[model samples]
Target: MVGLTLLALFIRLNAQDGILLYPDSYQFLLVIRGLAESIPLDAAMGAGGDAWSAPFYRLGYPILAFPLHLVIADPETAAKALSLAAGTAAVPVVYVLARLALRSRVAAIGAGLVTALSFSLANWSNFVMPEATAVFLLTLSMLLAYLTGRAGRAVAVAAALTTALLVFVRFEMLLVVPSLVAFIALGAGQERSKVLPAVRLYLTSLAGLIAAFALALWWAFGGVMSGLSVDPTSLFQAHVIESTTAAHQGAPALSGLRDFLDREPLLILAGGMGLALALRRRPDQRWALWLQMLPLLLLYGLRNDMRYFALLVPALAYASGLALDEGWAALRRLATSQRAAPALAVSATASLVVLTIVFWQTDLTN
Candidate 1:
């Protein structure tokens, strides 16, 4: 099943870069190209010619893609390779998350299926963006938090460090770190019945966060070889704030959200339905749901367009799965007394409507 998901993931891979949607991807490619061409990592390349040669592109993607310099001839080919690898790595992480959350093979399989078949993953799996890598790390990071009880502090620390790397992969992920920390702290407190152990564990995990920041600095500032700001909040504010603030950005946050609400009302209904399910069982799971929900959820009412609200896809899809699973369970019980078909029909119709609109919009964009 998981293998099939990877196959599904691989088939959607594409090497194209379109700056109109988001220009930073090309800049990243340029950075990798510079390293491939043996350009001095320190020298700042002008934004017009090769914006990527600057220090900000120095993150882990270059390190991971370095081997491509020796092999792939085409620049796009090389970039695609790394992106594919990252997207591929995310598959098992989703599987692991499913196993941890549901603890049932069928449910885990279902969860993994929902994650892998995500149209967003399919569309951008091979696109020259760090989204796949960042998402992979995000899933891993969440998995680590979910597994905090079973794993030792050292393991949790390592997972936190990986998530720290994700912060560089995509700045929006940083928003979830607090919820994630809360998730970890709450779990630790419950297990040991002491807050100090959880505190120690949480602090130890900060090492990974520090390491991630150091790597990001090196990537952005040329790893001690160039001059660039190392401040953490720089990218976060710029990408999420300024880009969205652009007068007519492709994915304007609020307007897009309004369009979604006005057009595809079902997705919102589905999300609400899913939230209700998560709320019902394992009240403790509420925080995990919230941790997974926050970063992308806040953009809901603000989405000016579909693409602008894209960050919500994975999180929402997970919610959809939760809703689907929970809804089905309730329907099963409802079947004994009343009509389960109506509930099933409603979820299916809502999901189908949402998917259809999104797919149509995607084709129109193409």
Candidate 2:
């Protein structure tokens, strides 16, 4: 299923209809090209501008594309090729994360199936965006972090570094780190003495991430997110500029989000309910989910909706798996104990397919 998804999305990516998702799509690609050319990473060269402040988003993708850019003068195609690969990898990463979370092979495959066919997700591959790569990197990092927490001390150090790298890929991933912290703390038997040390370690890892981001941004662009001179205290105003500018560069954020939900209400609702159910299973998980959703909510509530929510499709997919799991359990209990096997399986498969179709079809391909 993961292979099929990779082929499906890669074919679509290769056959893109020349639909540039946003005006700024070229900025990142161009910046990578310029970086390859050894150009200064300043707005003069496209780094410190509103068009692109952080050119190293998912640097793993661009690094893979470095050879491509060297060979192909048209950096857009090279950069997008990298995006496509990362997007393809995201399918398996989603499966891995879902499997880790749910501890079910069938559920994991089912979740990846949903993620792979999500048109919204596949679309990211066709563009010069970091969401696909970010999701893949962050999800993989999340999985490793959780597993490390389960394993104990030696793995925890590596987990810290990997989790930090994940943050460097996408800033929003900071929200989910709590799950790793919890896993680690819990692994330490949650003894009172262990909790404080775990907290200190997590904070230290987070600080390392922030420092890494700052150093990378400074070295690559000579500024922080373009070195915009916004006051730290004026976070609201600064965000207003960023949000408004981002909308102007593409569609109004909220408007597009509203359209997405309107078109795929059932799927979105199912995903949300699944997330709620998963969170309800544990208090710490609830806090982690809350942290994950809170920033998106705050940002979208204040401005246009982000078109890149599909990039987080794996997160959505895991939640959807939970929803499907619950519904399947309920239906099985409702039907005759041993007679409705075929019907139950058919019903479950149908719901999952419908969700995949909804996600694929409703993508804002423009």
Candidate 3:
């Protein structure tokens, strides 16, 4: 875990120097600077002028990066550092998530390695945007939510808090709430006697925390939604309906998903197989995991931005790990049963060659 995290950090650090800064990156930098300099939220929101709405509404990333900004004295560098740190931290979190979901150390380590080396995720981590931070928090929230069944009430509360923080980082992540509820409820159902109590406690705590957080945001910023956009219909139209319409006109609805798959074809293919296997082998967790991934999948199906798919990396890494483990086991069995050592060696070499070509053809940073 430590080695994988360091590898991820090193890669991100190297990737940071040459990365292009987008409009959103500057918005995040403005938010970080505002927070570090003790500027009021409203003033900070207006700091970017009328061109870009202040990203101050997504307070979680700025709050985390502000201290680093004060110390580093460079908002962009500080934001990048925070992103790199969160991305690196997610490697081990991915490992733990994979372990919990797959029950195999080999699979967990594979997941960790995949996360450490994931090109799309690494690219996002080098930016001054909130994607990396959101991904980290989302993965952590998933882990905590998954543990609620075995770890009990405190973990459930922690999951809710983490989810609240996640929403603060990326309002789109609010979609995760229903998925989390499904995860907790399905997990609790395993404890037949305690199912209702567990579900009630988890749901009640999540609601209370969300309500308190929303009120606090409203009190502090005069609004709970992102920026000055308080109208739910406007927010929905801007983020969802407009994107969907544009996606349909510009390209296929699944273009974003297709582009994501193009970048990591091997992992996606393996992960799909692994998920199918898991559905059969881990009946208890199948729906929970499916629900966790469904919302994002549906959203991306209607959008053409591949960057948003970074949120799915942790889950895909875990499934890829499972597939890799199963493949290795099958190979060993084949080699042993058929006494085809030479054939097995050639096949392994050919497989590696194909993977090398695929990776070599794909860009690790965009």
Measured against the true structure, the TM-scores of the candidates, in listed sequence, are 0.74, 0.76, 0.84
Q: Which 10 consecutive residues of model 2 have the lowest summed lDDT?
A: 223-232
Q: How far does residue 278 in candidate 3 sit from its true spot (Å)?
A: 2.7
Once fitted onto the true fold, the runs of candidate 2 whose alpha carbons sit more than 4 angstroms away are: 1-15, 44-73, 179-202, 216-240, 244-246, 249-253, 263-267, 279-285, 331-366
Instruction: Please list the Cα RMSD from the true structure of every candidate, rounded to 1 decimal place.
Output: 4.8, 4.7, 3.7
| Model 1 alpha-carbon drift over 4 Å, by segment | 10-22, 41-58, 182-199, 207-244, 247-272, 299-308, 334-366
At residue 351, give the lDDT of candidate 3: 81
Error of 2 at 156 (Å): 3.3
Give per-residue CA lDDT, model 3, range 1-366, as digits (tens): 888889888877777666889666776776677667755444324323532253644667877888898899999988888888888888999888778766778788778877777777788898888888888998888778767755667577888888888877777788777666655655455565555555567678777886787677557545322235455455445554433454334676667777788787655766687778668865655665677578778766656777778888766776777876777677777787766687588777968975684455335544
Query: Which pairs of residues have clashing backbones in candidate 3?
Result: none
Rank the models by TM-score, top first: 3, 2, 1
- The candidate that wins on TM-score is 3
Better of 2 and 3 by lDDT: 3
TM-score-superior candidate, 1 or 3: 3
* TM-score of candidate 2 on Cα atoms, chains taken together: 0.76
User: RMSD to the native, candidate 1?
Assistant: 4.8
What tens-digit string does per-residue lDDT give for candidate 2 at 131-183? 66676666566566555555544465566666666665555566667655655
